[model samples]
Target: MSLSPQFLDELRSRITLSGVIGRSVKLMKAGREFKACCPFHNEKSPSFYVNDDKGFYHCFGCSAHGDAIRFLTEAKGLPFMDAVKELAQAAGIEVPASDPRSAQRQEIQATLYDVTAGAARWFEEQLSGIEGAEARTYVKKRGLDDKLVRAFGIGFAPDSRGKLKMALATHGHDKLIETGLLIQVDDKEPYDRFRGRLIIPIRDQRGRVIAFGGRIIGDGEPKYLNSPETPLFDKGRTLFNIDRAAPASRKSGRAIVVEGYMDVIALAKAGIDEAVAPLGTALTEQQMEKLWRLVDAPILCFDGDKAGQKAAVRAGERALPVLTVGKTLRFAMLPPGKDPDDIVGEGGSAAIEPFLAAPSPLVRVLYNSRLSEIDRSNPEDRAGLRHRLDDLAKSCTDKILQEEYRRSFTSLFFEDFGWKGRDRTVVGDAISRTRRDIKTYQSIARSALYGCFRFPQTLLRSLEDICKIDFDDDVLKIWREKIVDSVSARPFLRDDGVIAILEADMISPPQKFDITRDLRFSLNVSPEVGTARLTRIIRFLVENEALSKALDELNHRVINDTGMGNYVALEKMRADVRAKIKVIRDQEYESGATDAEADKEELGGAAGQSAASATA
Candidate 1:
């Protein structure tokens, strides 16, 4: 079905590139752009970017790029027309009746992307001038080296009223504010929003600068001010360090998710480059999916304090359900009152290496932190802590892991309660209760209750991606194996099956507390989203039939002449484009539509004229 132009525009407007991208990838706000793992390819890190203002997407992993339609066409296998129609439907806009105007709007949007690019260049050049000396000194003082500053495209925004606004105007362009490069207080006058600060231009994976993050020099009230969610940037959906860390993560087979800029930089400096951080907020599940694509296991490292601990809990909860047998997670806590940066700063890479080396298991971290606060000195506290511990233990759907945890934890109680001297362990009774817990994979048995309504067949790939990998530690390995098996079994089961299987399962209080979170934030996904994704995959496979067939043939040929086969593949793709043009021409001919009738398409007057002459 064809979608109207208006509908397409609205759909484009309704879905921020950041949000759509953020759903699958974690993005940290870098200036106005969101950065995260390049979902287009496997990586151990993030280097993909989505620009809301510019309406562009790019990935550094395999150098893929284009607008949303292009992304759908490539990633989801939507024909350009189908993607537009779907987006239009989603946006609730009827496609524009006037195709010509719809076509014209495309050019206007294209011009906006160009204008943004031009403005970025101007900003970079200005930063090199004396006016930018202060910003330069500031970044340097903050411990960013010259190469790092340049790699981040560190520029300076002059403290002037509207130098940027005027510069754009002088260039015969006035769409600066539309790109969020500048802002206007009143309709009459506009000013650059990023002036007089150390500018960090945020780039998508293709490394095109889309937005800016500015850090003010010392004593400034707001030390760091990011660009307002402009047309091109959204803070909630961007991940910092995606540009540099994606490849590292891809290569290393893991991703390290940190808490802040300093933490990311400290890790990078210490040679642990597969780290990315959020844009000064709690790490969202939206961010975790991004990491999932790059590496099998994504390690969550937060500060050691209360807030950091809370963040870790949230991250753990979000990522656990997603964990599969091979895919795993570990948590790292910084020393009290210190961040990754603090450790690196105080003692260099050597000091912080141990923390990364000995990251904590998510289960242990979550349950342990909560357990410490309870006082066994009182009976109520003891009961409460037992309830908490019981709940937590129940969260593990793997009976073996649950059993192990119960046994291990029971031993701890014996030691803690000084029961090593006395006999008859009450906690030992809790261990027996735990034996029946997680006797079944609930999601697997209840296919109808696939959590989210949309689950995918290709999800098997994701299932394998997360579940099949083993970690160095035996405890973590065992824990992940159960998660993988439970989630993988979900696509085939009925809801009753799930209940029947899991009813036998019981969790200690601490495990229960974390288990719910694990379902929400961890590897567990909603069946609806998963199923929809699978539907899209089915559609894509059908749409790319010609290419798929050709690829099959080409793969056979590549075994004989690898280099020549690649050339042949390119040639075939080029031939396919030409074949499409020929088909379009024939269709227009059969329809008896003259060039004049379709002049509104704006595919260059030359094509129209040639077709007109041909018809004549």
Candidate 2:
């Protein structure tokens, strides 16, 4: 059965080679392809590889190679006709009958390939001839050398419409029109579609010319023109320079996407060859899939302009529904009012390397783009942003990936606003109690600093805790620093001596506070009290501050997350922190009371001794 070449091409394009082979062989994703143990020749390690982009399976172990049909015939032991019928049915395409007309159509399709190749050669010749002098000058002015011009198959279409028609007349006007080289109207003579323009050929995976893109040499309404949709060319499914970029991407471990073919060429001239561009359209799902077949995350290097950002957003949206675990995109933005061409042209590939080196992830780009449209300060606007982000995350077909995206978006949103929120009622009364605890901790910190100044000896033991204090007031911080320096310099300095040193350094001691006055005074003057009271105070302050921070984070999580399991977990954590703070406060109060009583007894003993001495 002789199937038409066009039918066979469609069959291969529609069927994914990995999907077919995966039915029998276990395939694992290897960058730009899938790998499995060679089924024909068993081995421990995987030497068999399948590339859906190029539509072929190869085995390094046994050197077995074929396409979808061949796989079915050899692996499944199906006849060639039976394999073709099976694939055609799966692809939802009708198998062409092996008749005289099918053979004739096959012959015509073969000739069409020849016609496009012939036209590409003719355009190249025109570029190097007298008629292309203006186009050649334009190319030179753009910094393209002769070597690059030939490497990219850069050519020219003359101003005269009939010239291309006459040059390729032997191929017949019908074939030329079918390949989109000549424009034909109803009952009208066909003429050249591209005239007075510089041509760049668009090729398939096999490096066969399928279409042409042209840029006008001078002022024109449409700055760029592309060949109309032909049997061999579908712009949405095609990318410029894909044939060259596929291998380059395999070596580089990534592919670079630009806004135009010219940008791709510019990077190529700068010795960066792993670049491709969408053909006159925003990137489509088909185009993104093609890129994923080359690398996990292709870098989309768009111009740093309004339109370019919009293009990136569109590409991101298109990719959301089909996203998998390992497949994604990264975005690179050029400097404002510049492009890859401008960067490479000015400073060679070095200038563009930085932008490509640290491209933003797709999620960040999407989140920021949506975030920029709303007023972050407004509650309603912020809620709207969350909703939009949630919707975007839910669009992913992969459930695990969807959940991860949700977490990422949520984390990003909270990071911008910080864990602080206006809700004081989070997790019942936890947030309200935390607010009060913050004030209590601040007062304890103040009292600790005041106590340190009075008894410089206490500072010697708790010097580490003293340094850990987060003083909000500059004056208090300065005072604390001076006291620490004085005490650290002389560990046995008395209260009056330390005070004198502080005064000498022009640092004022903290004003006495009534909040914990008895405990503070007893801590300094009474050696019977020891350093335990001051140590407990500092520890209480530190623990309270840490608790407040942890509770704040949990509060934010509990409020933002709707999952019952997570909410319950976060609530329990908040409860535990509140309980811990209560225990610390209780211990401090009990210890303070006992020390106050001890000071009173010491005073009473001194009074009795003084009275007895006076009486004698």
Candidate 3:
């Protein structure tokens, strides 16, 4: 039975080669591909390589090569038919009964690839030909040598559209149009898509030219023109210089994502070859995922101006929710009004090494970007900063990570501005005095529970464990059960989502306490401080509950006259629980006093600074 070429192409594209190879081999991302020790042959250093976009795995050591199906047959020892069936299943493709049209379609697509390859060769010929004198001069002026130009497959698109159309006319106009070398419009003959521009062929992972990017030699409106989406090209999924950068990234252990093709070529000329650029678009999720596969965090190189800073922030925001623990982005900003190409032209690639060495982390860039946007003088402006930080924290879907970010931003806020407009002494004294009684700890735990509901983001990491804890207080237990049930039903509730759930159920706190008052107390405290305090209180409750259970078990043992060991152990456990309670309470008091003194000092310093400024 013959499979359709289109079906096989789709299957190859769908099955990420690294993932299939990774199952049996320990594949580590090297540049734009994954590398592992050859499963076919034993070796110390890894030589087996898998390029997912290219849909093939190769071993340099043994010269083994094939796609996913071949790997299954050769490595897994499956028969040819079985391997095809398995791969088809994994790729979500249904195998059809023998079809002859599949082979014809495959042949046509192969011819189109040939057509694009032929056009690329023609472009290169034009660059070195008499008509390319102007283009060659421009290339020399940019400092790219013959070897560098040839390495990047740099070519020249002639000014006349009909020139390329004439050269490849033998291949048929339909093939040229389909390959994006020629553009066809309604009621008009097809002309070249790229005219009078420096041609840079964009290749797939396998090093086959898939599309072309053209930069107009002189003043042009669009400046750069890329092939529109074709059967084999999607701008969002394509990155310039990726074919070379992927392998280079493995050696450098880094993939530097620059803003443009010029930056990529400039860096390469400067001996920094592990650089790629997005094709006339902001970095997309697919691009980031690809970059991550090559390196844990690809450094994003942006311009140093306001526009560049804004781009960095936007990229960070887009990456936040989907961010896993290890996967992230680093940012490199060139000097004011400068770019990678400009810097490399002036001082060489090593000049930009310093910026790359200390590229700001995603979190730092996110915070600093917001700070640059807002006014810091007025109280209202500062409040806006707080809200913005909170929103960014809430955007994180990972509960533990979200809580950590919330605390980090809160700490930064307090460190820079300190608490404002609220009486810290009064609030501290009230909490300190009220929390002295053991019963108050339970009340605080209950309030913390409500806080988790108020800000559902808080429940992300702790919800499940908190739900399982056995509570002696009837009212608090009821609240815990309600929260656990609600959260279990809708696990991803955020912001006012918890409140909406409660409102729908008409749930209210027990009449013994005012829910509003407790909520205000919890909400008023700085999130980091509140979290610490509540966490400690919860620990005390859990520890105390364990002690009580032990004492009860001892009593039953004594009633049955098991032994004096039960009574002695009970007394010792009781003392340990009391000591633990004392330690927690004392630590809380010390921390509270330290924070209060710090707040007062900050306020005094701010006042003094203001008075000095006024006098001056």
Query: For each candidate, what is the lDDT?
Result: 0.59, 0.82, 0.74
Q: Please report, as a residue range, the 10-residue window in candidate 3 with the lowest summed lDDT.
A: 419-428
Candidate 2 C-alpha lDDT tens digits along 17-109: 999889767899999999997866647999999999899999898899999998876664444775787787678877776788975876676
True-structure lDDT of candidate 1: 0.59
Candidate 1: C-alpha RMSD to true structure equals 31.3
Candidate 2 has what TM-score? 0.57
Candidate 1 lDDT score at position 416: 52
Tens-digit lDDT track for model 1 on 513-532?
33332232122334433343
Model 2: lDDT of residue 255: 90
Better of 1 and 3 by TM-score: 3
- CA deviation > 4 Å runs, candidate 2: 1-105, 418-616
lDDT of 3 by residue, 54-140 (tens): 788889998999999887655653446656766776787766646578656655766877988998999999999998999999999
Instruction: For model 3, state the Cα shift of residue 141 in Å.
Output: 0.4
Q: Residue 435 in candidate 2 has what lDDT?
A: 72
Task: Return whichever of 1 and 2 wins on lDDT.
Answer: 2
**Model 2, residue pairs in steric clash:** none
Sorted by TM-score (best first), the order is 2, 3, 1
